[model samples]
Target: MQRVVEEISLKAWPAFETINHRGWLMRFANGYTKRANSVTVLDEIGLDIEEKITYCESQYRARKQNPIFCLLSFTNPEVLDERLATRGYQLIEPSLVMGITLSERSLNILPIINQETLNDWLVAYHKLKALAEQPSSTHHMILAGIQSEILFVSFKQNEEIVACGIGVLESGCLGIFDLVTSPMQRRRGYATAIIQGLLQWGIDKGAYFSYIQVVKANIPACNLYEKLGYEPIYEYWYRVGSNSGNEK
Candidate 1:
């Protein structure tokens, strides 16, 4: 059902390297993020399911990275999920893939968008999450590899970046990623403003649909997306490989 836009969605997220093992798709993006470094499109084609799974596992192991299977709700064979569960793979980040038709969306607010603002987003993301002092090189790679039309938006207060987000467009399907606001700026509608700016940017560029992935545990983000008319038509989770899979 969502396959049409899903293909475009997948294309928008260009991985650095991809391998096909008998119709299964595995992507590697320097292990910066899970979605870009996971196995998906587990099609029941030439190889048996177990064989495909084994190949996926071996490939990641050879690369010295843990394998992650993205299990989608509408997956064919219906039993794929069960097979993964039986293999000691733990389910993680049961996330909602919310999307909405963008034809009806409108916002009058302006966004401060350009390549230069990426540093602002990086500062906000690192500070708000309280992550390590040094950032990963793969993050920069992932951001730099975006081939489609994109925009980096940031809002400032008192001359400091308070909120930031990014929008990407591919074949009329716009994807929003890495939307983060300063911890001190929460509940001030800064996040909402960023979302509105992103949406309007996409719409003005001829986008008619938008998609966002939010973890189910994020109540506030889910509520905000719902208010924007984005519904979770389907969900997916990562089948962690018991190794260094990004469980969250």
Candidate 2:
């Protein structure tokens, strides 16, 4: 069922798109989509890696102008470090593609946030992005179309907003994104709570399954998803490369 849902959703909108970065090709897509296309990075001196990195940065920056660059990732590509050497774009922490099954666990529906609580939710989101090295924006306008949808955030015992998550209902499934907890707030099962909340919310909306993406090397996250009743269906590689005047 989950596989079928993913296939239909992908076909409808093509969760990810590929871009050329001057001889290097990269995948740039909405992070909420959970699709990592591919990226390939190769080193060349005269072309200047810094220039290429700048161009790539500009591409996303331009995307932000349209309110679409809220979240994105540069995935696994050959010779990434080698190409970034000249650009000084330091590699950030790796991520894993993790998910959960809606059929295997009992979920609880948390209360919705009121206008007063919306500010608090935004703060929590900002903190999570800070920890994850993600870009920041209060693009509530972008979410205007989704006002009827529910956004869930789970707090710790001290109300420190430890774990934050969101779910988008499409067809018969829920796509989860922005699941993060503070480093100091780890090991309190907050992640699990949020997942349960999101799953329950999806089921309430008549969803058939839940899906999310995590870096392959994130052992803790992977284990957590497995414990929550998620199993692997397919794995895709991310490759980034600088553009070399190729149109395709």
Candidate 3:
């Protein structure tokens, strides 16, 4: 189950470049989101774990990025995390993969709009969360790189967007991402409305399950998902080298 979710997630949130060394997949995306730029260890337990780590560090260093390793609870060679810690890597962003089985449910979708163009969505999103020119550009690249079916749903009030989220549908699962609500408009049920609508869309498309990745420290987000019937599926965290900055 972990492997399946990880595979779908990689496809849902793609990287600009991916290099598979031995077994680990090293991703790079101009230092955008850590998820897009970190190395992910799947099911391979190749020999020379130390050598592999050095190779990954070199690769990321060449790209001017701090080395980051994303370790899942079920990652192979179980000692990888300990080995990384011994090499001066610090743990960060302990997060959970939450999921729920989709079923029939009444949805109160707010006055939301489905963006037609990437620019349109970005414009509305910028209104909710400020993004500089460079990050805005990189975010656009990441979103445009997704090949699966996507939904850019935004909640509007008085003709202005107050909250927004993205739904990526693939392999009978809906992977939710980029859920953010305007600071002043939060706790107003906009997020709940958007989530209900997204889940309904997934069910309409024959999806059996829906999932989201949230940082453990985000209490409101964790609570929101719980109220929407999502449960913790697995935990993953990043191990950042001494030189790497924890961007995002």
| lDDT for each candidate structure | 0.78, 0.52, 0.86
Q: Report the lDDT tens digits of candidate 1 across residue range 1-248.
A: 47665666667777899998766889998777788999887434343778788778888878888888887776663566677778877788988889988775456666554343566566666766668776567776787788999888777777777777888898888999888888878988888888888888888899888999899999999999999899987787888775554322
Which residue pairs clash within candidate 3? none
Runs in model 3 lying further than 4 Å from the true structure:
44-46, 76-78, 104-113, 132-135, 242-248
What would the per-residue lDDT of candidate 3 be over residues 17-61, giving only the tens digit for each residue?
999998889999998888999989888656798889888998998
Can you tell me which runs of candidate 1 are displaced by over 4 Å?
A: 42-47, 104-106, 109-115, 243-248
Q: Residue-wise lDDT of candidate 2 within 72-151, one digit each (tens)? A: 22223334345543343334334443455456434645643222244566667777666464333423323333423546
TM-score of candidate 2 against the unseen true structure: 0.56
Score residue 131 of candidate 2 by CA lDDT: 46
> Could you tell me the TM-score of candidate 1?
0.89
How do the candidates rank by TM-score, highest first? 3, 1, 2
* RMSD, one per candidate, in order: 3.3, 8.7, 3.1
lDDT of 3: 0.86
Number of the top lDDT candidate: 3
Ranking by lDDT: 3, 1, 2
